[model samples]
Target: MTSRKAEEIQHEGASGGWGSVSGMAKVLLREKPTPASLDTLLHQNKPHGFMCTSCAWGKPKHPHKFEFCENGAKSTLWELTSDRCTPDFFAAHTVTELLGWQDYDLEMQGRLTEPMRYDAATDKYLACTWDEAFTGIGATLRTLDPKSVIFYASGKSALEQSYLYGLTARFYGNNNLPDSSNMCHETTSVGLKQVIGSPVGTCVLEDFETCDVILYFGQNPGTNSPRFLHPLQEAVKRGCKILTFNPVREQGLVRFINPQNPMQMLSGHATELSHMYLQVRPGGDIAAMMGMCKHAFALDAARREGGEDGVFDRDFIAQHTSEFDDFAAKVHATTWHDIERESGLTRADLEAAADIYATAKNVIAVYGMGLTQHVHGTQSIGMLVNMLLLGGHIGRDGAGACPVRGHSNVQGQRTVGISEKPELVPLDVLARQFDFEPPRDKGMGTVETCEGILAGTVKGFISLGGNFVRAIPDQEVVETAWSAQAITVYIATKLNRSHLVHGKASYLLPCLARSEDDVQASGSQSVSMEDSFSHIHGSVGKRKPASEHLRSEVAIVAGIAKATLPPNPTWRWDEWTADYGKIRDLIEATYPDQFKDYNARMFDAGGFYRGNPARERDWKTETGKARFTTPTVLSAVGVGDAPGRYHLITMRSNDQFNTTIYGHSDRLRGLEGSRAVLLMNPQDIERDGLHVGDVVSLVGDAGDGAERSVGGLTVTAFNLPSGCVGGYYPEMNPLMPLWYHDVDSKTPAAKGVPVRISAGKKPT
Candidate 1:
């Protein structure tokens, strides 16, 4: 077998060893952030301190001295960098000139110091007062119909800010509250809600303590959530086994050395995580799930035939779940031949995995966007639920389906009713509270928002925080559609490509990052965030603001709401802005069942659990039971093979967060200094008569007739399953057709774009 390596690689011993320490120090030294800002990491992921604002992983009840991970450190340091995007900088560079700069270079220019409005005549963004910018934006918003306005929120938003922002949108007369969740775990929301009648995951951080087995469908913990490694290491110490099904055999899943462990760090001892690691084909999670489930049924019958109690949890399935017969029928109908071909794994491999799964008393199945960003992403989620249901994992202690959310408050944002779909939040309760009729229009999501913009229906766009244009798939479509908007307003901390993709009228409003202190009239207020585990906690910033002009997200949202809408007695914009607790009190009113005693509860040590009804087997669906969902396609993405075509899944580096590129380095994967690279299996590369380091052009087709292509991607040999390839996102994003997405969830099919590789020339 040929060696799997990138052109320029680093030899790191393992994930989160000295390598992680080096990476963290490298970021701190590179950015040269303030010493006070560096010291604030001691408070990261701790009580009465700011949340990491990185991943949605729950903090420990008692965390280590340095609770944050390397990635978390990078995200914070990157945000707190002293480099500033001053008015002088903008004056020196026009929008067109800045647009030509690399994404990393543009953001490295640093944080926006003040509000800026695009000057068409000068082709530059001119500094403007907050009042002037807000007044202009509010006037523009007031002129547009609410349906034409896309109120977008980033996952990093605090629960308070998210609630206020959502309210601001609804108060403006429509539910066009599209957010980062629409692009990410929307399939998880759509899928889990259908099966369990809840959108959030059931497992808490403490659940890892008692869980015997963890199954990672597509989650890469080392990069996605490095703090997650601590739990995995602990679980492994307690004899808990992990099984993974992914195209990439992520080193994090294989081994990890906790930086907090002095002995381990000194000795460089790494803990082995995955007991069984199956390199499932890209977009093959559904087929693999089906095979496991099918084996479960076979084992159950075999045990029953032996005149002993069966391995299956018959009583739990019978009482807690419905449609068992239908689910079993579908599983039985799926042939072993199809499963092996689709999953790229042998029957023996699956049976062995099933054996391990069957022996475990408690198991937690966790997943990331690898399973969600596909054409059949929703169905893939359904298949996972079906497998777990057969084992009666739901509602059991230390066992359930856990969707590993990427963003810190993405789940919290959704919990606060940031959705385009109606019936998610209680509109009547909102109307009763605010004394205004909430519009019932079915609004837009990320994909729908792009379509609306492309069709010239979406005239206004307002984002809380995110690289909106770069984050979503169908980069070509979004880039074209972005200019169709009449107005664009971004409440952000740093500069990014999304700002460069300007509308007819554009405004860039700087906002305070999570680590910065926000002093309101009431006091130095803390923002509350909900983790992926559904735990809500208070986050108090200790570091100074990036700029004096930067406003809190809560203040900005309230300012917009007060400016755009007619003043109602119920809308106490000043009181809410001055004190975020007041906003939490209203959030309690909006979601009394979940957020009761919201102010007091969040202060509880390690915060409070928002409790999923599904965890208690209290079904919120019409059937009043956790239902079994059948899948139409037993594939991660419904794509067929064509000559030279490969399944290209999007990836993130260890040095990068969602959309925020820290640097051009991925230490764990051995690749560095370039994101414009394609990872191909050695066998595939050899078969295609290609050499490592050869530049290639990727032409993508979703059968939408819109052939999208990007050239000059360096091809690197990797240990992926045959016919599977990997590449960094935003770089490979253009190859994914904008129109192609999940049918049920409408999430972009980023994980499995049908791409063909050919010889290409280097970019000038």
Candidate 2:
């Protein structure tokens, strides 16, 4: 065990309680002054107010007085802050000069105010008219092949915005649309699609009310989706056991005191969340899942041989599933020795977890990027599905798969049609409705976009929202590709590092935040979004616009589309922007069953379920049944390959969301004033002959012949599985080679970067 006495970094007991209150107030006070700070929280997350612009955790059917979390508070308050980055701020600082600033400092300059164009002569952005900016983008794009244009989407936009953004890409004749999901939950989508015939999870938010056991895998609910704790707290109170498997014993999993509960807050009494927390190896989820599958199969066989009831749901399997025999054989072939070695957990640990799973009447499997961002992320995610399918967890009262998505509407973005790979139904419908041949060629994802940029094929880039450069892995590859592009356009609310890396005809177009009012030609409109539970609802921006010059994302996308296309007869971009309902109607026409009553249902206070076919046991797969698949690999990461090689897991801070850092404090781990730090086992620290505060460098040891290194990371001794280390994301992204990714999903293996420790100095 590591002692906090000598270490500079400090971590407190549990997550939430009075600490959350203090953190919320600190964030609000930092952003807003006097009464305005209090005003910001008044209508937030309310019926007619804006949605919390953080995680995609669904709002309850009946919301509490306080519907926001500490991190959500940071996101909302930051967007509502009075700070603005005007044209003068851009005039004073050159893009080259701003490149020197850290990511935290770059965004701290506040929200962008107007449209700006990049001038190579002065190397500074100057204010330009919206028409002028659009014309430049359209003219440049017209000269290139449609396949060379990349449309990057962010989940921050409303459902209407994302829908139109994708449609616009298809209008220009290309399926090369990639969004944030390609980086995070693409594995969940692909994995579930293959098994249950649906890309989305089958579970709803209310399913937790009657759950018996929740197999939580590699997700930190407290920081990523804090509102999820409400369901977890309710589950614990109702005697539902949560078995958590992770590389580190995160405070979120240990305990969480709801600040809304006055008694729990005043008394400092936190509800214990996890009944059994297993510290698995960094990228050991595949092995851990197989361990449970193996045990369950063995238990069923022995019980059946004794002429007793078996644990497996034989009837459900025979009726609704296929390929069970092959899957079972694969599990039987995997020995306990291999499971124990790869998972970094003993056989007893696996057996104990399996026992809880087998006895539970209703179980829900929940996971996040920790399971998706691995070399074999798709296989690990499929294993979770396999474990649930054995007991017929799908379409049950309280049991199903719950993939906790990262962004506010990442799942919705994919559902509405922002994808590099499009399903044929939508394409057929879109093609028929518009009377144009939709491109059939495979488009580019984030990694593919980078590769294309290097090969001098993809030249133009358009981003709806997000810090694309910082969020992607292989910083060198993306940066090198940026200079080769002919044009880059970013429609955003604030400045990020990606804005500084300009092309010959780069642009920065400011848009309204979700919390701000958006009045089109029709009237003040409400934007809609679909949550992780497939619940679609409207978010009316109650607050005033940050700047008079700012426009809504829906309008910005429509403008770009109209400008790029030569005024086609079938497309009515102007009318869609005037009334977003028309856009939603077109969306319904594209996906009739999913968006049945698109406009009417969006305004409901609790929203309406979009409905998943798999949840109703109506498999849309080619075989008309759920299919079981066996993983091709024993482990997602290699173990004990060389001396001093540690599996480094990149994690997020409590004070941050995705790649956006609000402050220097990481309240969950109790670190302050620095984001560049590495966490290691105390025993490993001793073995490496390093103290708690020693500076070190992580040299990428993937043996890919790529010399990648990240220096100036302070070492902190903490409790974790041996041969595993933890560090903040984006900072450690340099060590992750672009080629080291999942073959199936092409998602970067961010959770496990094999690295060797070396002496380093703090950046001078």
Candidate 3:
């Protein structure tokens, strides 16, 4: 057996100590853990089905045997574990004591057994009945100005739960639904709605199979959506041309070994996924995409001058699109020099990518937060749509724009009106259905919500799920704003750091996990989830509840609504909570065209397909056609003063979710036991006079008077681009300044933060 470094060992020994460090070692390494126990555990199911709440990354449950990734398995184990956080347990510890524990240690304390109310006098959480909790919440809500309240939803929530939450909030006289989407994919929804009149992806999972070429930009599905690996592997095996453009050369993109495939698993064979990989700068995605489009347009022009037919989709452009000439002119006017400097890719590379696009008959472009978290996020997406429209790749089989979602059903949640700004149709239907005049005013989004909290305009917060404080940028400011609230309510399954940052009146209501059986008044119920491909699936939880006191999210919302609202003759909150299907019926009535016979459609096949505007080549724009959007050249924000200051791109390890770390192990990056290592290019290391394993401090030149130093980082040189560095997320989130965010999207540009890296002893 080979001796691995302390940083390279994933699993702890019996004494809970990591392995020792060795000499120079390879960077990319993987640990193949045995899955026999996981397979056995998944097979012996209890009732409905098992859903992992830890991460949005999931695979379709297969018959005969179900396969799971390491993180997925860890998530399942955590949910299925025997640990419990009972009321008596909380009585023994003060809020201050619990706040002192690490995030992992808090969750490791186990599942929240019951609803808890913060007792300020005792400085501890006391167990409360669900009815009591709801009554208290309702009283607090009823006293506050409705506009001062924010109903925040997370992606982990079910669509049915989200629908009820929306109704409850609107019925309470406000549409301030500040959800997780506002932080992650608000730009995607905003931009797509403007261009196509729909925010969801135009393609389905099946599209990946038939596409001749798939252009992936800014996402590593291996970590974010591990289930996408199977499709990519199958696509490559069939000779599909897969091209990738990312700041980092993702290990999952280069090669993928399907754990589901018995032969491959037995033989330890991995399939080559990406045929061509281009390393773009952190915020250079827009330029690279635009450059590709420019080259494609030039090619189309040349072919047309030579009297060639079918070079570009002229008929499609003329019939289904507007502003093509202007968009084309802007592309033509863009100088190659500017594109090269901005994108950090040469003209030759852009032409090569263009050549691939031109030759491939069926193409699909997939993007992730890498494209959406930048200042130019919206414009970047529009640019990709422009490229697809130019070649008429969209609205066709195996070709379209796929915005790979981070959380499961995040797209579905948005579809059901979990938005800060309510759509016209949903609002109208909501008003007609409930008989109350819906508020016409646009509500505050995530950024605006934080601003409102800071300005003392927002008074109360009711988050359905998510660790908002940890996930949001400028942690210090977000924490302060949260503390300023009069009341803060968190409806969650387990403990998190967010619970610690409580308000004057705080409540932690425990809810049944998605993988747990919910025997409500109506009967055993099921929730619907929409995947990246627009396929809606029915997920019924089969596991036992973590605790009998844990109420379903729907029930909790109904309880709150009943306590707060006066009895309305038109609506039945009690009846709806008794049965979720009735809520679906209301949803169908709201979007009759999309969800007609909602219950019947769900039982028809795997699930029902939501309306995909691009499938029929229909442009639902205000002009009844797709409009080409042209964005001006924008300058990138410099991180620090120095030129050689490395721009740090914060990313999640394979072993971690957004803010939850299952363990300190990143198999692909060859890091273990610790996540405080910074991956730098060898040239950068030599130029900066640093060596591997050297502890360093990253100093940010905080514009405002604040702490400017983050320390105790171990340096490791790898195959990264020069003047660039990579580190784990959440931990490195502190380095990102509060003001460092995309101008338009307000999304923290976590991928690109300019910092000065110095090698020496860790800061005291």
Of candidate 3, the 10-residue stretch with the lowest lDDT total is 15-24
Best by lDDT: 1
The C-alpha TM-scores of every prediction are 0.97, 0.97, 0.90
Total backbone collisions, model 1: 0
**Cα lDDT listed for each candidate:** 0.86, 0.85, 0.74
- lDDT of candidate 3 over 1-764, digit per residue (tens): 11233223222111100111111011101112224324424632112344445334323434325444445555566655567878888888998898788777787677899899988999888988888888889899999999999998988787788988988888888879877777677777777777876676788766777999898988987667665777787898898988899877777787766665667656656687888889888778778888888888888888888888645789889988889989988988989998898788899998898888888878898888888776667787788888788878889889988888776677778778877676633787788788898777887777777778778888999989888878776676667667778899999888888888888899999998776677878888887766666666666776678787888999888888899998888778778878888888988888788787887766434345777876787877887887788977522343432565778888997667777766666666566777878888766776677767789988665456566556788887665666778888776766776666666657677777777776677333
How far out, in Å, is residue 234 in model 1?
1.1
**Which ten-residue region of model 2 has the weakest summed lDDT?**
1-10
User: Of the candidates numbered 1 and 3, which has the greater lDDT value?
Assistant: 1
* Candidate with best TM-score: 1
What TM-score does candidate 2 reach?
Answer: 0.97
lDDT, model 1, position 440: 89
Runs in model 3 deviating more than 4 A are 1-68, 634-644, 701-709, 737-739, 758-764
Candidate 1 residues 1-764, lDDT tens each?
A: 34544222323347888888888888888788998986789888888877888998988788888999989988889989989999999999999899888888888988889999999999999999999998999999988888899899999998998988888888888788888888888998988898889988888888899999888988888888998899889899989998888888787888899888889999987898889989988788888888888887898899999997787888988888898898888888989999999889999999988888888888899999888988889888888887778778888799999999988999998888898888898889999999999988788888888888778898999999999998877786778778878899999999999998988899999999888889999989888999988989998887888888989989998888888999899999999999888898999998888888988878677779888999998988768888888887767675787777898888888878888888877888888788888888887878887777889988875666776888878988777888888898778888877666778888888888898887865434
Q: Rank the candidates by lDDT, best first.
A: 1, 2, 3
lDDT of 3: 0.74
TM accuracy, model 1? 0.97
